[model samples]
Target chain A: MKSIAIIIKKELRRFFTDRRLLISVFMPGIMIYLLYSLIGNFLFSTPQSQEYKIAVQNPSATFQTVLDGYMQSEEVKDTYSLTVIESDGQAEEKKKELENKELDLLVIFSADFDEKLALYMQGVKPEQLPVMQVYYNALEQSSQSIYTIVTTLYDAMESSLANVFEVAGGNVATESDGFAYMLSTILPMLIMVFLFQGSMMMTPESIAGEKERGTFATMLVTPVSRSAIAVGKIIALSLVASLSGLSSFLGVIFSLPKMAGMSMSGLNIAYGFGDYLLLFANIIVLEMLFVALVSVISAYAHSIKEATAYSTVLMIVVMLVGMVSMVGTLPSALWVYFIPVFNAVVVINQIVTFSVSALGVALTIVANLVCVALLVLLLAKMFNNENIIFGK
Target chain B: MEEILRAEHLRKTFKISAKQRKIERTEERCKVAVNDVSFSAYRGEVFGLLGPNGAGKTTTLRILSTLIGADSGDAIVCGCSVRKQPEEVRKHIGFMTSELKLESFFTPSYLFDFFSELHGVPKEKAMQRKQELFRKFGIDRFAEVKVGDLSTGMKQKASLVISIVQDPELIIFDEPTNGLDVLTAKVVTDFLIELKNMGKSIILSTHIFSLAEKICDRIGIIVDGNMIKEDTLAAITEKRSLEEEFFALYAQIKGENL
Candidate 1:
């Protein structure tokens, strides 16, 4: 234990003594914050609906009145500007215009749409079900938004004919800016990405660098157990790497409101301090596992450059694993906690969304600890092997 | 003089690929690095292993220091068998070589302190030793400077200081002054003599004939992984110049191999 403390102190001193390393340790967070803020600003402030151009064919009084009312009701007026096409030839020309990007959307209502709807309101089925042909170019953002709004408008009109009110998509849940949802959705990927990257940044330098510089042989010659040396390095690396991960996470958290938009009032990103602590614990464990794995790879390499080459490939593999978070929330399972990089991603996702289980967190920690212990043993064995330690 | 280290026919071999084999193209290969090597060094004595590169001089020292295990026989250091009690051997030995470079990022003082703790030296004793050695080697003036920033001579001095910080009973140095200025070389030879006078057992390897002629009390000439000659320095240098004798023996071994 005393030897381990001395080893840990030495490893940590190497990390904290270098000013350049200190900056690099914290640089990822500052950069991630800046990057995410830029993306959020772009997403939040970029043109949502830039005056969608729509052509209507064969407008009816009931449909017109409902559309006009919706257009005037403080939401859609500035968004949608409409033109009426009287003839079939004109409707065809408008369709061409919509395809050519001259128009954002086009709606061809059946000539007897209002008439058939009135009959339908009287409990009689209308012929052909009052077909409405909607046209919009999928390539245009404005057209997509207008399509959803127009479809909602028609649904409202059809419901009014039956003297019933309906909500868009029947999802009466108030529209959210998805601020908290965004955190839940994106935070896991970010955390996994930064944790792996942070471990990569320093782990190779600690183990392989020592081997290359011949410092490791000095340690091996000492009477201290090789296991103590490996443990000290892994513990110090995990702490340092977790700091980098935390830096990135804090960057994203502080910049989230700017990304969720200032206009989105009461955005519920209601994760308490305990939840963050859980998330940080998960990050620490994940960092430990990754740092140990990277250190082993680094030890296997002949030199720092070779270690870096091997770890670059491992880094890519880890990043690909992080992509599992982007596949969305997984159904909770005991098996979910058994996957290495993925389990931490899942747990962080659970923590952010407030759906975590006590059991899942425990599994993540225990599973990672087991794997880390196994890896540290492997490193100790490596320390004993002259070929590995000397990189002969 | 009390014997401090002994090797009894220590042997080791390494398997290698026959990539250089042109005719047979067979991969079966092995090189016996240490073959039945035997030697001993005593307190108040400097035993020098004199050989050209790859002659197994380093391997012999490494075996005695327990840096590697012997394949056949064993070495005893301070009454501890290297194979069964390597950690015990390590505790009583200070092994140094160009291969065991101090980490460049560390200051000399920091490295001294680190190795001191690792060797289980109490803080106060380690500090006293550090002050004594650092001042002795003139490393005290730049003890806080990172080794990478130091001159080559300073780095060599720093390596020497850290290795001896434990004050082990047996000191193994491989090619101790292979590359150093004349003044620095003099410092190292002077230090080895001082260590010998203090009743420390020292095993040093060098191919430089002049270095061995200057300080070694006894010498062994190793060739092709075997100790071919062993005698007092005065006995070896009785008639022919040591340099001429070395080449004569080297040429004789080469003739035998061919």
Candidate 2:
């Protein structure tokens, strides 16, 4: 225990005391925050929160009665205005304005007699539904709002024709499920990436750097067991990497609201504290796996620079495996949980989406820790090899 | 003098890859680094292994220090088998080599405490010994400065102080005065004499004939991984000048290699 503590203390001192290393550890999180903010500002600034404009052609008396009933609410009045124009030329002028971003929407209805609708209502089926053309530029936010508002008013039309939508069965997707799906896909992939990055930043220096600078030989000459040294470093590096991963995670989580604009409400996460506990537990295991794997690469490498290069290839491979689970598609087999980093990533996705099974989560944690143990053992064995440690 | 260290027919070979050899193309290869060399040192005597560079002197010391294992055979350091009880062997040895570098980021003072703790010395005793060694070696003057930022001599003194933190029964110094300025070299030589007087079994490997003559009670001349001669300084220098005899032996070995 004393030997392990001494080793961990020395490693932490080297890691925390270097200002350049401190910056490198924090840089990924800061960059992620800036990137998320920039994307949110660019795409969803909610341009010009203005009232809607709707142009209507000739309308039937029945439609007018329905519209009046739908527009009785005061909030509806403040958000939208109906301008009914009978002349084709005038409606065409409004359609042109809609395209130019001046008007919000244009609604054109075919010339209709009330007798034609009455006949159709009396079990007389028409070959086609009455023509209604709704025009709005999808790019403009106000136009989109107008489309949604006008469509909502015409929901009365759907109620009149009960056979149309039929509004059947429970919806498989909740309104919040969209946000959960997004979180599940994006965060796990990013978590895998940032965890790897954080571990890579320190492992190469802690292991390979020591070997290169000849400090490792001195440490080896001590009475401390090689396994003790390897275990101490693995735990210490895992902690530092976990800290870095958490920083980036918080940056992305906090910036998600800003990135999503008014729809940030979707991200409110119905997840309770238990889900967060599961998420954090998975992250801790993942950090251990990553630190162990990177330490192996560092041990294999002759120098810190070579270790960094080797770790890049490892990161790319891990990210690729992590990407495989990014879509949150159910695995083809339960045995997929046996694969190391990929299984952890899938488990993270499951946790975020609130779709994880207790059995599957347990399997993932066990498999990941198994990998970490194997890697640490391998590193200890490598430390005993003079050629590997002193080859450079 | 009691026998404190003995190495019996220790051997080590390394496999070099083509990429490591920097050749365009080649098969895997092996190089014999240490070839069945053996020597012994007593409880209170300085034994020197005199050799040219690449003559496996460092490899022999590394084996005795238990930094590496011998391919075959073993060394007994202070009654501990290097192969079977390496950790025990290491606990009784203090080794300073070109390969055991002080971490540059730490101050000499921090490293002193750090290495002392690593050596398992109790804190109070560790500090007392650290102060004594630091003051003795003049390392206290720059003890607070980072080792990397210190002058070469200061770093060397700091390194030596850290090496002997446990005050082991056996001391191995490989080319102890290799890269020091004259003043620093003299300091190291003097310090080594002091260590010898304290009754530690010391093994110093060096190619400088004078360093071997001045400090070593017994010297072994090694060439091409072979120990050609071993004797007391007086017995070895009896017939001819040490330098002339060394050149004649070196020329014959060079001719054989060619």
| Per-candidate alpha-carbon RMSD to the true structure | 4.6, 5.0
| Candidate 2 structure quality by residue, lDDT tens digits, B139-233 | 88898999999877777778887889998888899888887789778867888888877777789999888878787888888887777777787
Q: Write the per-residue lDDT of candidate 1 for residues A45-123, one digit (tens) a residue.
A: 6454367788889876665676567667764444567799899999889989988989988888888988887888788
Error of 1 at A314 (Å): 3.5
State in Å the error of residue A60, model 1: 8.8
Fnat for each model: 0.73, 0.80
DockQ of each: 0.70, 0.68
lDDT of each: 0.83, 0.83
Q: How close is candidate 1 to the true structure, as a TM-score?
A: 0.82
Flag clash pairs in model 2. none
Interface RMSD of 2: 0.9
* Model 1 clashing residue pairs (backbone): none
- lDDT of candidate 1 over B1-258, digit per residue (tens): 677877899898876645534345755587788789887777768889999899998888877777777789988889999999988888988998878899888999999999999999999999999989888778999999999999887888888888888999878889987767887777677777778778777889999898788778888999989888888888998988777777888888788532
Off by over 4 Å in 1: A46-188, A255-278, A316-360, B18-28, B179-199, B256-258
> lDDT tens digits, residues A112-200, model 2?
64555666778676666666778999989888876776677777665675564466588688657766777777777788898898798
Question: Residue A112 in model 1: shift from native, Å?
Answer: 12
**DockQ of candidate 1 against the true complex:** 0.70
On the 0 to 100 scale, the lDDT of residue B49 in model 2 is 91
